[model samples]
Target: MTERKVIWNGRVQSDMVDYNGHMNDASYSLVFSESLDALMETTGLDASGRERHAYTIFTLEAHIRYLQEAHEQQALRTTVTILDQDAKRMHLWFEMENEDGDTIATSEQMVMGMSTTTGRPGPFPEEVEQSLSPLPKLDREHWPTHANVQMGIRRK
Candidate 1:
């Protein structure tokens, strides 16, 4: 398995804290969303690339699990793993860790390439696909246990 690369880094701001005195539920999603942008930039989907190819990536779905609390001023880092991808869509897993290296949250997302002109799903441009080739790709068997979870009320 290739080592996952840190894609984004940030510190929890005072505004991100809730009455509980830690990052709020929505804040976790916000950080993960920012991490996605960083991933897009690395894959040649940045503003100029999107304009040049008339293409962009859109988040189709996202599931985030909060494992620990993040406090204000705590340093945070995020890494992404490409679980799978096709011509038009990608299954990605993002992990956010606190300064102590404890995973505070994880987000599994499905994103797709879209044609900005037509506002429809489309295959990624060749250059963008090529750029994504170097990123970490992990097989299903190697995925973390928390990944691919189905959310619902459980009863036995």
Candidate 2:
């Protein structure tokens, strides 16, 4: 894997705590959403940049697992990895961890580039592709797998 960037850092706030005395489930999603914005900034796909390029990336899917508990006032940091990508789509993962490298949660996300002009999903702009093309791509053996982490309902 390549060197991932620390996209987001924050301290768990008292307001984020719930009756269980820990950060609530919704807070995890909020933090992860902020982290995703940071990722977009790093790749020049943030709101302003998208406007300049007339293109945007949309989250097509996400899978989040609350692996461990994080209490109020606990310091946190997040690192994002580009698990896979092509011209138009990206598969990503974010790890939310404490100071000691203990992960509190993990989020897997897939996003696609769309053209503002056409109002349809399409290939990313050259600048966007250039910025993302260098990230390391992980193979299956090294990819993390969770037993109950599949995205949709399973039925016969």
lDDT against the true structure, each candidate: 0.92, 0.82
Model 1 residue 123 lDDT? 94
* C-alpha lDDT of residue 118 in model 1: 100
In order of appearance, the predictions have TM-scores of 0.96, 0.86
Residues 67-144 of candidate 2: C-alpha lDDT, one tens digit per residue? 899998999999887777777888888889987888889888998988888888988878777777665556655666
Local error of candidate 2 at residue 104 (angstroms):
1.1
Candidate 2 displacement at residue 12 in angstroms: 1.3
lDDT of 1 by residue, 14-41 (tens): 9999999999999999999999999989
